[model samples]
Target: MASSLTKDSVHPGTPGTEKTFFGHPRGLATLFMTEMWERFSYYGMRALLPLYLVAPGGLHLTAGTATAIYSVYLSLVYLLTLPGGWVADRLLGPRKTVTVAGLIIMLGHLCLALPAAASFYVGLVLVAVGSGLLKANISTMVGHLYNGPKDARRDGGFTLFYIGINLGAFVAPLVIGTIGENVNWHFGFALAALGMALGLAQYLLGGRHLSEQSAVVPTPMTAQEKATTLRKGLIWLAIAVVFYGLVGFTGHFTLNWALIPLTLIGLIVPILVISRILRDKDLDGEERSKVRAYIWFFVAAAVFWMIYDQGGSTLSLFADASAKNTIFGWNFPVSWYQSVNPVMIMALAPVFAWLWLWLNRSGREPSTIVKFSSGLVLVGASFFLFLAPLSIAQDGHKAAAMWLVGIYFFQTVGELTLSPVGLSVTTKMAPKKYASQMMGVWFLAVTAGDSITALLSNPAIGGVNLDKMGFVALESVLAVLAGVAVWMYRGKVNKLMGDVR
Candidate 1:
């Protein structure tokens, strides 16, 4: 979701000419703090969600239901980004959209802080909508702060911005997680609301430092197009309402059944989008070939996220119920484990960046496909690490905390290898006419993976048992799929990529 600004598109006062913040624009600081606090609120609530749902003092839901809800929420968050981006492009630009999004997110957290069941669900819906709107547009704004796409400082500035993200994520669980687990859960939610308030305050106060172009819609919809869009939206809304009414009338309306449509959307959208791209008469053979290659990468990324994102759901449950939460003679809350991945990212990101640079300089850097395959391998192997701990610790003894630490470390490496590279490749391989659509397709990889995770994690659907042996079998099958993907597609994908490497 990165954007490149032309000279005319960028505001003069905010581009590379400004050197107030670490030789970058002062706007970086503004955006840095804004995104930092946004992430703080996000990860803060996420760390507590699965555990909260199953806690006696909380909702006391079953693990399967909790994971199903978590996966569905995550899928919607990513899926709505498509429309979110459209909103920014066609109506309210990035700045206003971000402001509105932040306020909505704060309200969501406030709703969560209320002691009512209905409020809890309303809060989740609000937070998901707000996050969808805020996520990409804010990053787009950061890109506007640069001179253009080729600006040498662009990557460095983004790296610094990335640190802001991890810094917030790393600290959130320690503060909010500790409070939520030991104190009242509502208090922790209130803290998340406070974090968003702080972020919104700074964002508004520092608005002057941002580029004015951020408020300009890149492509305002024409009157005819707007009417057409509105018509289509109403039709979809009517369809959804009818479907809901039918389910209710039939007495088959349950949470699990309600989630099925989202899962289907996640699974089907990528296929339809890719098919449309491939069949576009405007695309030449070269463009179609590149897209064909991108399909493989997309599938690989989906599989990677399926395994990696379980850290919040399946792994969180494991930490709470199975992992020994003690180190140095002090027992810690389980949510602290949530911070490990971000902390690892902060430490390892620079190293990975340097490693890629060094390898490229020596002409030893792997192709994007190879790096993606490696990520799959690394993430898949990380799951196997659990088998060692599961093998021992008989008689209800919990596994050591270090075991989870090791797993997170490996997954972090895998993430560094694949995630950023995937984004870069998506932009490179996209047809010029459909560049933004392709980015949306990339996010669908996450949505699809999360949807599948939801189905598998639900015992009634996929019957994926939650026992140690069940986990072992599940991880083994997924790991084998990773291996099979590498074995089958590496050469074909490379050839299809043309000169993209």
Candidate 2:
């Protein structure tokens, strides 16, 4: 039987280890490069997928259908993290699981590189499953790189790591997206494969830098439990294979209908996971209270992402349809807008890092809930910026490229405020036994947000024919109101934290 998780069970980084990367642990570099390259592949592919769907000589799908697939793919990519985290926590260690996930992701990119439509569908499945495996566990490993309870450097380390992530995000669209958009789609996917391969190679070469504890599974299943788990996994694998086969062979499979099941999964999984954790007999009063606070954070994050993550779907469409592509007669790629986020992140992260340090030193740091509220307001404001001018743009006169840039700039600000904080807090609040799973729950909020974006992007779902700006305006208002409400309840939420913040 697996030992129950407790707060003390987490492995701390090697004490007195020489700081090789930015005065942080040597492992930080390993993870930093690994995540950077991973994001490059992931975001590069994302930048192309929607465009490919609507392009000639491609899937040639409608905007609604293409975005629905995009949304489902993104949702599944994060949703799978729950099981992926479970696998790492209970079966393979984070190190091994992440390695395997990297390999699968490489294969997924290769699948996309093939010219066949079937390859495209199969590739999406592989990437989504692989991403699910890698995302939560890799993040959890980052948390493991520091000593808990006394690690003042945890948030700063994640902020620095976030820069690496944005670096990849910044570069990928420029490189892979250019070739994908202008030259050939499969070729672009090929470049993404190359990126992942490089990342995997770097990870293998730099394994020694990582904390030794990451290699040890925290919870080990008993023989009986392992058998049951294996059986269930195989059955699900078989079902997935059958479903993929049906979709690949019979042209009757509809992505719109597919959303129904995904919606159910998105809705049910978090509830079950949260309930299981909260009802755990292992939790003390303080831990239970922390879990409640975490739930509130989860909701706030979902709301924020619902607005911010439009970059891939609705925002991408706007870039193509509404935004003027020419900058001083030099036409930029639609995908290039995707790079704006990473560029801003790269520019602003250090500033925010310094700001947080200053705030902490001055004893004026925003409470976690307060920061979350600020993020929500900023994301909402990004949408309103778009609505302000585009709402009045004369028909057929494309909005300026600066408008999209402005939106992404503010959205990046909101992301910096919430994303790193969300990762740091989840790690702090997680019950030791369920650490990886809790991280998965935090990502589940992203999954829910992505699902909502997908649904809203669908014309069949009343997302079409609506004045896009009006919708953005309404959503922006709602998000701002939601942020204010959370801020009002901040005291109650802080009480739930019990001095952790």
Candidate 3:
């Protein structure tokens, strides 16, 4: 039986490692709230970004310019996880690293509050790097809260963790974005900073529970461990700073520029090569097999996010352009419609949690990989469901609100299938020594898929035909590709995973 948070909730047979929070670890709730606030800041800022820049006399950028900046910011935010993962694994543990990152992010939000073109670049840089560190590592710590050999409870914990994410997301646009829209744009940024401050406080308050876990397993060093860590830290910082400066400057001027490709090649490719090298260079039996499964899961999740992340890019635009919604006898900001997915996730998660446990009682539950592949198909299927309205409409008129809601519903379910599971898979399968590294790779897939979404929305290529069946056509093709990828690799992938069920 698990212990309670007020007292240490230690697992049976694991002494000294008492669980800390509501039937979970003491630190779990702390991290949960931290993530909640961080996400609140992120999604809140996201709600106002293009609207702030492109709406009326804001920045007055053309659609292409706005989308370019949006996509670049999105891509960089995910891409920096490579360094973030490296820093946590090699130098700082997840806990402290996230501490530094939260500060950076808070500073970034402050920059956004500054009324200058230069503030845009500085604020985004802080946000991208700060998010890169916090995103992968905080999720990893939730796994540590469960200490057992291949502990099955981990996924449920992560799903719960994700619920915190959606909760913050649900409120962010309504609260911060709404304030930014009606009160002041800078106030929205200040709100984001305030949220980050709260996250840092929770993390600091809960540091005791996290001290036990190392973001990475230790490696032998010729010099002292602390010294070696410091050296690597400086090196990583220098590299990141150089790239940050370059990207910050280039992004302001060069569209179709080096930022995406350079960032991808500079950061992501090395991780890929390292993972492959690790796959072939070291391990022998099942360990190596798990490594291979890690690769497969990463590919599958990338495809999933490509479609899923539309919530920010295409879906954000859809809300602004298409959906019709009103609350309290007034039209809610169109962006707030984006809240429906997170809201659905928050409401549905407990039901799915119960459903999974009930199914397990019957000795029937889908494997994580199967769920992931199925998520792609299900989410992809939602496109057709949405396309139906546009297909049948007599003219190129906006589709009804039901269509957007239904699509978000399917996307939320699909996220439930794969996303939380993907995190557990990485933590379980990755080399104990390379946990954060694999997490970084997992994030890379997301960056890749999301970048493709950005590419799709590039107006030079013709903005997605939102009023027609065009968005549906694009996603349908991706779904087919995802299905094919799954068919070809499922056997190899499942075998590597051993008895995951």
Candidate 4:
């Protein structure tokens, strides 16, 4: 089995022979832990952001405003990964880029620990930029550990890596959420900062176990190219600043109005990026077909995440405002609801890993498109569970917590089928020269989803009012779209995937 692995598999030192971490490479342990803590910091802060924005001691913003900011912040976090991947592929390489990004994340959290509104916005900006730089490149480094596309363990390995991500996510809300909701928000932010600091420390200590390819630039830019790129970036920045300033001066710079343009950008950027990739002269016929197939997958994932990612904003608000937090007469913090999805992931991921492997051994494994379709259906169905609670609870009464749990359960199953699998498929289908950048492109689906989510959550801008029927209608439409994709394009997409399955 080891002999079947490519020469570049895993780390340079042991290559295919290493299996120190649960029958995978030793480096998986290091990368797993690094990602674990990064997620801890990220989810920890995220669990509090929407809640804090409406709390009296915090920003005291309205629900619409808070969710708008939350959605936009999350959108930019994924959106920036495109350039972040570019920087890694062309300049610093994954190892250095991830390291520097971690530091920036820590700094952002520290700023959030301060008690000023200006610092709060600054902290969000820093965290968004830093997270953007770190997210895709770190995932790319995981892909670097695999042998060429045929390595049977790749999906399972990514599943295990995803478990590490959920480990942090599971623990974060329990810890940081408790502190932020019960004690002080800034202290909770401070704890999140500490988590990032620890992540960086362990990552540096474990650097030796990683693949050397992670430190090598895939396509190093020449000095002239660097100069040109820098000039272009600065000019774009200047143009954006001037445009924003003019909007503010014209007295039409309300938060909801600002988000409308950002939502459009989110929708448009993916189209532009996909077009560029499809037109790249370097791609062969097979590669072009795969990219085309990926477009369907991308749209499917966007729909899935559009509904799934709402757990932090719309659902959190539901928990805080309407859900009864008592379990056996013990009241709990609403932020703790954030832990449910991750906890479900940790429990179910191993089961899924075994299921996929078993199915593969029998030559009956589902194609990626089938898995994606399943995910979309499950996540979209999770929203219908809300109707049950909404039906029973009347006269401002709180619904049982179990209803939310049920919703999270379905969403968790959907995420297991989709998110990690999406990561694995992106690594497999990426064009050779555009590898890291393709990971970024995958993240752009999340960007698009969150952008749409932001627009939908805000009632001031013709968004869904999120009433009982409105919520049901919005998710129902998404589910129907998912079904249409599978019904119309499944066979074509599977064929275009070439040998990927």
* Per-prediction backbone clash count: 0, 1, 6, 0
Clashing pairs in 3: 3-9, 9-19, 20-25, 20-26, 21-25, 21-26
How does model 3 score by TM-score? Answer: 0.87
What does candidate 2's lDDT look like per residue over 118-145, in tens digits? 8898999999999999999888888878
Off by over 4 Å in 4: 1-19, 245-253, 256-258, 464-467
Name the candidate, 1 or 4, with the larger TM-score value: 4
lDDT tens readout by residue for model 3, 1-501? 113234645464331245545445556677778899899889888878877766664666665556656766777787788778767876677777888899999999989888777786789889989999888788777767677536545666677788889889999989987888788888888899898888788778756655366444344343587787689889998988787688777765454554445434533573565567465655667777777667777767777877777666555665565555554456777667668888999998877766776676686877776777888887787776767656545355655666778888988888888887787777777776666767777777777776766665566555543334776677767875785678567787788877554
TM-score of 1: 0.88
Reference-based TM-score, model 4: 0.94
Model 1 lDDT, residue 250, Cα: 97
Best by TM-score: 4
Ranking by TM-score: 4, 2, 1, 3
Better of 2 and 4 by lDDT: 4
As for TM-score, the candidate ahead, 2 or 4, is 4
Badly placed stretches (over 4 Å) of model 2 are 1-16, 236-252, 392-394, 460-467
lDDT of the structure predicted as candidate 4: 0.86
lDDT of each: 0.79, 0.85, 0.72, 0.86
Give the Cα error of residue 405 in candidate 1, in Å. 0.8
